[model samples]
Target chain A: MIMTTTAQATKTAPTTTPARSIARLLLHGGTVFALLALIVFFFAMRPDVFLTFVNVKNILFQVSILAIIAGAQTVVMVVGDFDLSVGATSSLAGAVAASLMLTGVPIAIAITVALGVGLLVGLVNGILIAVVNLSAFVATLATMTSVVGLAYLVTAGTTLFDLPDGFNNLGQGRLLNIPLPVYFAIVISFILWGALRFTTIGRRWHAIGGNVEVSRLSGVNVRRARLLAFTIAGLVSAIGGILLAARLGSASAVQGGDNMMFSVAAVFLGMTVIKSGASNLGGTMIGVAIIGVMSNGLNILGVNAYVQQVVTGLIIIAAVTLSSLKTRQR
Target chain B: MRIKFKIAALAAATALSLSGCAASASSSDNGKPLKVIAFTSGNQTPVGAWWVKAVTSKAKDLGWDLTMIQGDFDFQKMNPAVESAIGRGADVILDGYTDIASIGSIVSAAKDANIPIFAMDSSTKETDGFAVNITTNQQQIADATVGALAKTLGDLKGKTVMVIGHDPHPGIRMRADLAKKALIAAGATIAGDDIQKVKSPASGRTEALALVADYLSAHPNGLDGVWVGWDDAALGASKALSEAHSNAKVTGVDATSEAIAQIKAGGNFLATIEQPWPKILDKLVQNVSAYQKDRTLPKTKFEADDTTLVDSSNAANITPSDKLG
Candidate 1:
């Protein structure tokens, strides 16, 4: 009787153990699992189209600009600060660049000036938040409002189009049948990931975000780190805005304004997947991928755009809740 | 001393009588210029900005005392500004490119002040407050766009078309609905079985591009055409078709320069409707001038003008709507 009972217990333990481990993994990496499940579900539902090469490329191309903007937001989030002005910064840069080109400014010069505008905005934000000790939220909000006004002023409340071909190619041009923006997104992501993972400044940023007081006492130069984070965010956001203008072959005051909310949401969604429950570049990319996939899938399925939004909001909530529960378990 | 006081009273009465006569004359049209308050909630938009410039120029030509109030799509700012301008006194209030529904407070204030509001592109239907509102015919615009799609596709029957629109815009929403019904009536199937609504006008192009690209990815050759409510989104749809090497035709309203150029290039962009904004504005200005000459309002409370469809044949001749002075 003892031998028979032991045999049954051993059999039950093997099956239960694997199931428990799988559940734990899914709980910890909720965003990643959710993304995988979404992809699989879409593919299963539309086997011929959802997983096709062109469709995959389409998804990547559509998300390229978003990936860059979300990455910019992630940089700020890493330092425990987020900028609400990234969208406005992008729009202002694009408008400035486009208007300059219209006035016979060389494309190179216009693009450089645009990057400068972005850097300047970032520096101003850093000064106000880091140097003046103002709240990042309030300071960035002020900058966002000012930048939107500037965008309108630069464009004179008109859409600027018919850009030079060379400049348009930055957005619409393709390399080996892949959109240039896709390559830009990938390179930017890698560079950002490297900066966060390998560089000494990256470690300092992590420390500062982990514990501001401790990092300050340890001579980590918290102010400079935080300032740099904001500046980088501004610069990256500008790149995104410029690309968006290129893609459309036009620049308008409101063109890049919608990225702010989406980028913040992507960063928040990304935070749930990491064990530290902190924002990371990889997790942000996954978050962006998830959003891009959901949009593409729903569009392919002919779902109402409004309903897609509701579904996305629900997924975010679910992912965060699952992550929170896992944290409680730990 | 009594005689001097009697003389002073006689002089005062005479002066008072003459002043009253002058007041009566001024009130009865003694060539006083109209005090005009031109308000627009959409002054940040391209067409809105053009309206501001055009109205200002018109007011100057008519020698009207014009105060331009740009709302920048903010009712909170615009309502109070219009109310203040009303309080300060205006002969007539001119509203441009702002939905009448959004300015209920300003309308109430105008009503209280007994000032009739002349509006341009403010509403599709006649509201009580507006003396007259002139806007483009949305149903006509839809018919033209959908007709272009049908013509390009060779036949509407058994064809698949996507109707893209931003629902927040009343004109766009109405036109999109009309276009969808027209497409179905013509025996074409609506892609996604509904109008694919763009969430925001600011991001309409990007969203439209994604919407088309995604749909094309699944049914690469399934789509015959795309009907967009505005030119910006049409441009996006055109780009998607271009990238995919698809022969699907695209049509849009708002004869923006880019849309005209696309039509001229004979690409995926097949046609666009020019709303004749300048012509509409001129008519409104004329009506206002008639009112200034004699206290009069338009006989019709709501008027919708027909738009010109700019396809390949007439694309070159039509001055792009964006370039209007």
Candidate 2:
């Protein structure tokens, strides 16, 4: 009986290997394939405009701020926690920076204070979850609401305009004809990717997310790691908010709050590519790119905004479903 | 000793209760200041901010005990605050820059409390919830803006234009539809065969910039004119045209400071419509003060004020709407 079973297993191994390889390819390459397909499809539809250099640059420029915020989200998500306050933090930080400048505070000082605010919000979130034992969702949600209220208070329930030109240059200025925010997005994405891929702290965060008990057994400071994750997310989100205010030449109390949902969507779209199904910076960037392409392509084709929104919803669902199925298979 | 302490506490409580009743009774007396509940969900917009400042100043001048509520576009927060204020008792309410549809429950609550509610730009057509709804005539505004665009383009026949709008805003929705119809009737083709709807007012500038830039990328000479529902988005469209070096003249409503500056600078911003918000507020205040003097309501349930067309000729003369306060 043992000999016969061994013979049969060997007989199936050859055929099953190819099948598994195909499945793996489909699971890991789905987002990339979709992104490529979208580009090709849009290019075919509008041969005169879709793949042009200017349009591509426009897509990058449009997604830059989202990329920064989404990158911040990816950091928190990797540690098996969500920073729901990112968007609110962004709005508050931007409003603070702008309000400070209006009140005659030096631009650099104002920006530093705004970043400090973001860090402070993150620390509070960290303490709530890591030290106080509150669930991440509840803790961040509470902070998000409070932060938004603070944003309204800071701006006096209005949009803040007439920011200094020197500060606006940070958002609007160009390097060789490309917008400055785009460079910030690229640089920040790279730094996040590197940190996640290499540092010991990054490894510990991944371990804690994978299994907290095992991570603790392995001597990792699980609480401190999680706290660090929330703190980093807050700081990065603040950077994104400041850039957004500069880019728009104005800041409203709820302006950066709109980025929250899109950041989550981008992160979810990005998670499909990793075999481990872990949230990753590369995947998030790809996710952000997919959204930017879809929106830009649809607009170029003159599709209705409502219909475009629906299509985006469907794409996110499909990508997430694929990732979920792959995880279940594992 | 405990019984004596309790008796003293009871006496103190009774004295405080009497004082509270006296304060409450004074607010309702005919000779006292008019207790007003003023609120809006759109306090973040430029016009909405203007309304807030203007109403506060007006209330102070009128010596009305005002309970100002800033919704910041959150109905969940604004509604409850308004309801609580109503529960506390008020002589009248002022709904500024908030759509009636969003304040239905608040209106019903105010009605139950027997308080009259006055509104400014709450709806395109007069709705039943408000005692008086005064807004700019969206159709007339569209007519004037489209005419300006046509004149700038020298002719509308065979010209291509884009009408951008946000549907959630009643006034913008109505005027955008009217503008599209007027554009087509004048033989101009609507770009993409429809209006480009913006998802959020907060991000209107970037979205508008992308729309114009992408459309121009595909059709280098295809766009001749753009009519945006608001100035923020129109300024974005103008910026895109400048970048593309396209002579596509843009028209916007709400002659904002940025739009006025652009118009004066002689770029693609052709004209903007300045709704008489200050004038409308003045009229609403007069009626409210009259009602405070004696129980009275406006003669009409709804009123649409005439809007001015601020082209380069008048752009310099008109005060920007953001600074209207």
Candidate 3:
């Protein structure tokens, strides 16, 4: 039986291997190459401004929020599940935190509540998918719509501003002259990387993602693993929202929602790197960086914002397609 | 038991009829506490918040209960808010109409409910049968900015002046158009191709830096002067100049606190048009109160006070900070 299965796999592998190889190259290599080329182009276009340390710092600071949100998104997508509501969850958390702070809630307590709200949102998503047996896509999409509606209800269609000084530091504060948000992203990514690589729960998520029935039969407790994955995703998303609120010094109902689709695109693109079709933390980080770089570089190049959105969407599609091709090749 | 059932049915019918009559009477009443509903299109941004503050504070003073509804700038939320207010027998409704197209339906609904609607901040020249439309005079703002820029540029008529302004919003577009006309009249060669129209401040600083850098690199001598349509844009442009070491004179309308600070800091920002929010609020209250006293008062159009030019020379004379509403 093993011989027969191997022979069948070998026969199918030849056609798929080339595609996978190409996909891997495009997903992993394309962004770096594009970024380098953009840098060169901008340097030539505006030598004084584009090649400066101040500009680089500015770029990183600008993309820090996207990186944080995209990193959280990467974790969720690893188990072959998507959380559409992450953006709304982020917005809701930020708005709620800002509102609480306005009401004289201590920054720490406000942040805790904001994060708690995110976890609760995640729990709902996990229950809907793992316990109630709903499709991840449908469950998350519903949550996204509901969460956005809830944010509007909370704010009554107004922005929450005049945030406490301490809250602003999370986004603006720098350690050793580096932005606090950048550090926050690094810490979160490392924690996620460690958990996914070293923990049994993380291994179980991958196992269930690869084959639910087999994992279940092998005693993986698939439902629980999926639930845990979703819960973690929610927590991370909430953190992303809080960071955003700090950065902007205010929170509006739809502030985080604008970047939701972009973060998901990054996750999809991330799947094409390192381990094609497998959501690896390293690949996701790279994916986030690529998106950040593109946005930052384009803004530095004076590209129109409308045109920037178009370019971002196209790059994501190209990256994902390349990754799929590489996987097929292998 | 059968007689009791008949009497009970008759009582129920009478109650329903009486309630319906009372609703219609309240809806049409001239002196009955006329329900006034106000709808805004965003969870309060500065502009929306200021409007809310002004209207609600006036409502308190008038001893009126104003129903304020918020919409997330999406028509889905806005439509429901408008419908709910009309349903609640709102006799007079104040709305900041974000979309011009939605005004027709809103106007129709208010008319059907025998309500008079007043729109603030946003205006529809095509709107008919509305009580009054209150908005900032874009021309006056443009004139103020252009006059200031011309004064600063003085005799550099043929020099290329870059106009940085948002073009998507109708109000912004109107200001830009008026500014363009004024620049042409002043004999200044307005560089249309070099014009940078930014949508938001999310990446405003970066965009400003890049545009300024590119313009300086390309032109070598830098722009003669920059005219921004709004205060925030001016702030971004000012940062770009500071970074590029270019001494381009910058002028902007909407004298926000930050803009005033930049002017005070001795940046090349020559002047800013400060819209007197207090005057605007006072006018809004006056018009609202007048309408309340006489429902048949003709629709009035009035321009609020002009922009207060704040250049480095007279920056000290202006109030350092004023609450917007």
Question: Candidate 2 docking: what grade?
Answer: acceptable
Model 1's TM-score against the true structure: 0.91
lDDT of 2 at A255: 78
Query: DockQ of candidates 1 onward, in order?
Result: 0.66, 0.43, 0.14
Q: Tens digit of lDDT per residue, candidate 1, span A132-211?
A: 99999999999999999999999887789889999999999999989999999999999999999999889888888788
- How close to the true structure is residue A48 of candidate 1, measured as C-alpha lDDT? 93
The residue-by-residue lDDT of candidate 2 on A25-64, one tens digit each, is: 8888899899999999999999888888888888888899
- Candidate 3, superposed: residue stretches over 4 Å from native: A1-54, A88-129, A132-180, A242-256, A323-330, B1-38, B46-69, B80-93, B97-99, B108-116, B124-131, B145-168, B176-195, B198-325
lDDT of 3 at B317: 69
Highest DockQ against the true fold, candidate: 1
Compute the lDDT of residue B92 as modeled in candidate 1.
85
Query: Which residue pairs collide in model 1, if any?
Result: none
Tens-place lDDT per residue, model 3, A253-314, is 77767567877877766666664477777766667666666665665555666788788888
Candidate 1 residue-wise lDDT, B1-325, digit = tens: 9999999999999898677544532442766777889999888877888999999999899888899999988899989999999887777899998988899999998886667899998987888879899999998998888888877788999999999999878899899999999999999999889999999888888889899999889988878999999998999899989988999999998898889989999999999999978888889888887776677789999999999999999988998777876
Poorest 10 consecutive residues of model 2 chain B by lDDT? B21-30
User: What is the lDDT for B4 in model 1?
Assistant: 100
Better TM-score candidate (1, 2): 1
